[model samples]
Target: MTQQIRRVLVRSFEDIVIERVPAPVAQDDELLVRTTVVGVCGSDTHAAAGHHPFIDLPYRPGHEAVGVVVATGRGVGDFAPGDRVIVEPNLYCGRCPQCRSGRYNICQELKVFGCQTPGALADLFTIPARRVHRVPDGMTDLQAVLVEPLATPVHAVAKAGDLTGRTVAVLGAGPIGLLTVVAARHAGAARIAVTELLESKRARALRLGADVALPAGAPDLVDRAHEALGGPVDVVFDCVARGQSMAQATDMVAKGGHIVVVGVGAAGTTPVRLDLVQDREIRIEGTLMYTAEDYRTAMSLIASGAVDTAELVTATFPLEDAAMAFSASLDLEQVKVLVTADGAVGVDGR
Candidate 1:
């Protein structure tokens, strides 16, 4: 008899339902993890609503998750039944030029689990053994599950070189922005300020250690930010993923300041001001997904109590309520909304 597993998914764009999916047989060096918690991302809202490029009709939409190993394939020695882990979710083709150079997340042939394959909204998931990371000491699965997104900002901060005693400004107080603030602080920025239009998000950004949080496009935004920083900032992290914010931020940064764009932008639209970037020696670079080292750094930060992944989670719901959960995310219901595979977990329960 073919094994079956239940998955909370949409049969069609509008048909949300629980599906009896065929249980996947793991290959050697893979581990089958019984799903625990999966964080619903804002991009998941686009993919779930049929707007993402990689997703098509009817799919499970979770990428950041933590679970317990239920089974191990042949040759899988690092994990066995009952080991808790965080999922890396990225599957990069290692032979690509980007991969060989240690920038695998940009491999032209990259395939993300939720975007290109089965995701974490189901009863179980099979992933390469190396992609499963042990939950660090004293960190619960709930906190460990956020390693993916946290690592994103970690990689961006890495690209910024050194932040010791430098002023950093993060544009946008979304999930990535909020997380970036934490990482920037932990990376040694003397003062960090964030900009956002949403009042609630701005407030949350402040609570997360931002020296100040304010609206992004104010007439004197640059001057105001400098005043808040006690002078011009040395780095700007743009998580807004929009052309306007990018354009505005270019000038907000100091002459030699570095600006890193971690958010993906609309296709065919370039957000850079080439002349200014070159003439002023202002460095602006595009950052893709995190590297393996980025993940390691994220784990260390979590273990050291530097970044607060738990505080970033603002809402939760059952897996079967994925559609509603995604809708809530699209409506900005919270900083981060997670669709939990285990329904018995209360809103704030560990």
Candidate 2:
């Protein structure tokens, strides 16, 4: 293996370029993973195109990565050389009140892999021994890379408990939104409606079992969804996070229905119309990143084939062509574009 590894770093928006960074080192309680497939998330697109405010300069942007363990540091348990695993990415201070209370995802000092911390786009990366989850045996690296994004929808569904027989609407039939539709179906929602700007994504959503897929700026999106399901929706998983979708979510909810906001709200969009929710006496919720349980449940869904993820992987690119991967991810026909590296050691070692 080379001492220096290439990484996709973004020093400025529209200025993302690959560079050779020194390969990461591992210490006891850490594991060195040779990354394989990395999903280009919508957040990466937003950040790389200069839409988000939280990310800083010279950042390597990829959080959804799956790879094989090449070396495990001393004291690391339950893993060894050549184990296939997906990186959990969220690093938290265990001593924080949130972490102590079992809400590590919301720990005050949390830093996500590929966000505030170094991510898995490089040839080799290291993480706390606990942050690795073994990918199921014989799983394709494509399915492995989807674990992180898949977890987001799972967590959103979990947050909105007892959704059985409830009507659901997902605004934004993008990756997360489509996943939310799948999760809602798994939760036994009576009907699922998805909306998107792209006709191609909408068509894919229909194939993935959305009862209806709406145009992004549909004049009566909420009404149309309600009418399609024969009444106001019981839950609206607003995965677009933009004000328009949030507005539609507020309108789609029934009198006592829930609204779960799943998308990353770009830098400065504040949601409003509390009076509408207050009057309707609806439950509005905001979901952040996922927990370990969410990740596990997501992988289980994939392994069980409950989720037909074939339509989800709209495109793929090799590691060296990640810039092209990112470009493809922005295409109208793409739902997700993944960057992959060869897993030469996985089959024999796992």
Candidate 3:
């Protein structure tokens, strides 16, 4: 008899259901993880609404996750049952050109666990042992769930080169944007500013160490950010990724400074002004999912209490209420939404 487990499935646009599926068996060099907490990412919401270009319908949609190792397959040596771990969702083909060049995040045949394949939103899921990292002792499952998303900003900030004493601006106060502010501060930035559409998120930006928080639609947003930073910011991270925000980043960044595109726009395309980039010699870079090094750095930052993952979580629901959790994530006021499995352990009461 096959073991069964409950999992969340995206049946269609705006339609989600909890279905009982066969428990996945760990292959050699893999581990079976019993899901604890799974954070609902913006991409998950997009995928649910049929907005994500890469994700297809009738899929399991979760990547940011923390779970316990319940079983290890043959040949697995590093991890054992009962070890708490965070999942690094990227699955890359080691032989790809990009992977061979040390850029596996952009592998020629990269497949993300949640987007392109099965994910960990289920009660029991199997992933390669190399993709699972042990969570530090004393860390709650809630905090461990954040390590995956936080690794994104860790990668984005690192892409901006040395940030010490430089002024930075992050456009958007969503989870990734707000976390960018924290990463900038951690990198010894002299000043950090965040532009957000929601007032509550602007306040949260300040609380997260932003020196200035301005509304996204402010007529003088670029000017105000420059003034706050004592001049044009050395780097502008466009976390919103909308065409308007992308245009705003080009305008806000200092001449010869860098602009990092961190967010994925709803339309999946942006009309950028090449003249500005050419004339100013501004460096525009695009970042995707985090690398293994970024994951390690993110875990260390979380372990050291440098990044506050708990504050980012605004609400939680049981796996049965995943649809409700996805709906809650649509609210701009909410930062991060999580779905918990039955009997899942957390910092607070389960």
Candidate 4:
């Protein structure tokens, strides 16, 4: 008889529940990973509420995860049993032109592991060997879980070119927004401002390195961001990506500035003032998931003590309590919520 294990599934926001299924075995060129920790992302919550454009309903929900290898299949020699790893989650068709051009994040057949397919929110899950990165020797599960999330902002900051002494505004002080502050600061941004609805998140953004954190609903937000950064921002990392935030971005960014859309916006048209975009020559770019190089940069930053892992994770629930974890992730005061498997607690890899 096959062994049974539990995994969380989301049919809707009010319908998240744990379900048991047979444990999976590694296939060729794959590794079976036993999940240790999984971070609940803003996109996960959006998908649960049926708001995400790419992610559909009734799916396993774990993308940002840390795990240990339980088994390796044929052709997998890079990792062994007991090796710790972080899931990269972005799946791409190697034959795609985007993949051939070293931009597989936008591969024509690109599919995210947790979003478009089954993911690692279980006792055992098999993934392609190329999709998992070996965790550094002394990095804790808490820190490792952040690699996937941080890689995004790392990639976004790269799109903005060198930040050395550049002024930046990150709209939204959630996990991505707060991490954008960290990434921008690390890239040598001269000053950084953030806007969010919750005071707690604004405060957390300040602790994470923002020079100014303001209310997202402020009518004068564009001016406030300009004044806080000493002038119009040279780069605006729109972590909110809403119609209103895009408007604010266009208003606050200086002439010839760059606006990197880091957040996943809703599916539909969002109006943009093309006149302003044309007159000011603002460059608007959209960033997706990270590449292997960005993943390496994220790991290096985490290993170098650049990220405050403690400040980012607000709570953790057992694998059985994934529903509660998702609920906590939606809490206004929470920064990052995690779900952990048995024996994964207190073993911080310190």
Candidate 5:
């Protein structure tokens, strides 16, 4: 008899269902994992609502996840059954020019799990061994699930070069934006200010070490940020990629400073102030997923207590209630929602 596992599937826009499917088999270079905790991301919400550009309907929508290795294929040696690990969702072909140049995150033929491929929102899944990073002993599965999302901000911050003693501004205090605050704080930034529309998120930003949390719609938002930073911010991370936010980012950045685009918006194109960018010589860069080193650093930060992800988890639902979990994630009051498999809760009862 074939093994059967429960998984979440998006049948149509706003219609999510749970179904039992055959468990996948581990290939020669793959690891069979039992999904532990899967975090609901904004992209997942978009995909469910038929807003995501790349993800098609009837998709399994989860990318940020941590699991336990249940079995390893013939060529696998490092990981064994029962080892906890975080899954890197990006899959790339090693022969691509981008991969050859050591930038696999933006590979010529890149496919993201949960978007372009089957996701880990299931009881069992198979992934390449190279994409599985071991979870440290002290880190809980709740915290481990954050490693995948946090790696993105780690990579974004690294793209801005050295941030030591620099004043930073993060626009939009979503998961990525909030994590960026932790990353900048760990990188020795002198001050960090976050702009968000939700009061709860603003407060969370402060709790996460942001020096100041300002409302995104403040009439003098740029002026207030300048005053808070003692001048124009040295770096601006536009975590809300809408046109208005991008415009605000261009205006708030200090001359010759850097602006990193980290968010994804539904709009196909947003008008930017190119004249301002050209005149001030401001550096604008876009970051995709993350590299292997970024994942390592993210795990190290979580394990070493440099970043606390537990506070970000607002709610958790059993795997059977994945649809409800996804619904809760859309609320502004919630930061992150998780779906856990059976026996995933621990002594702490999380």
Candidate 6:
């Protein structure tokens, strides 16, 4: 007899449903994981609302997840049943030039496990062993759940080069933007400023180590950000990636500085000041998901008490209530929302 599992699917705008499906088994070089916690990401919300540029509707919705291995497939030796692990989610072709150069995050044939393919939003899911990372013994589920999400910002900040004693601006204060504040602080940025439309998110950014937090809707946001940083910022991490935030970043960055686009914006052309780009020599770089190195760095940061995971995750729901979890994630005040499998419990019961 075949076993069954429950999976979450987004069928249309603000329409998510849980369906029962046949469970999968561990195949060659794969592991069958019993998901404990799955984070509802901003992308997941966007996709549900029909805004994400990449992810299509009618798909499973999970990428940042923590689970326990129940079975291991042929040739897998590093992990065994009962081992706690986190999913890396990025699926890439090894033969691509980007992969050959160790930048598989943007491989020519890249397909994310959760976004582009079926993911771990079910009671049990099978994934290649190589895409799973073992969680340290002391790390709590809350901390482990953040490993995948934090890795993205970790990779983005690395694109900014050396930040020691350098001023930085983050154009949003949602989960990714706040984590950028944490990553920049860890990278030794002398000062950091954040802009968000919500006053509560701005306060949260300050608590997360931003030196300055301003309203993103302010007409003089660029001026206020510069004044707060004492001058033009050396780098601007555009976590919003919208036309307004991009304009603000271009106006706030110092000449020759870097603008790392970290967020996923809606599909369409956004205007830019070409004259300023030509005169200032500003470098704009796009970053995608992360490699294993970033995952390791993020896990280490979590284990060492560098990231405050508890504060970021605002709510949780059982697997049967996955749709509710997504609804909670859409609230502007909520930072991170998670879903738990039956019999699974998150740290602090959050």
**Pairs that clash in candidate 1:** none
Top candidate when judged by lDDT against the true structure? 4
Sort the candidates on lDDT, descending order.
4, 6, 5, 3, 2, 1
Give the alpha carbon lDDT tens digit for every residue of 137-172 in model 5.
888888799899899999999999999999999999
Runs in model 3 deviating more than 4 A are: 343-350
lDDT of 1 by residue, 72-149 (tens): 899987687888888887888889898899888888898888777878788788898877688887887667877888
Candidate 4 lDDT over residue span 154-268, tens digit each: 9999989999999999999889998989889999999999999999899999988999899999998888888888889999999999899999999999999999999999899
Give the TM-score of each candidate: 0.92, 0.94, 0.96, 0.96, 0.95, 0.97
For candidate 6, write residues 10-98 as lDDT tens digits.
88756777776777889999999999999999998888888888888778978998999999999887789999999999898999899
Candidate 2 lDDT, 254-296, residue by residue in tens: 9988999898887775777899888999998888788999998
Q: What is the C-alpha lDDT of each candidate?
A: 0.81, 0.83, 0.88, 0.91, 0.88, 0.89
- Residue 9 of model 5, lDDT score: 88
What overall lDDT, based on C-alpha atoms, would model 1 receive against the true structure? Answer: 0.81
Model 6 off-target regions past 4 Å?
A: 343-350
What CA RMSD would you report for each candidate? 4.0, 3.5, 3.5, 3.7, 3.7, 3.6
Error of 1 at 11 (Å): 6.9
Clashes of 6: 0
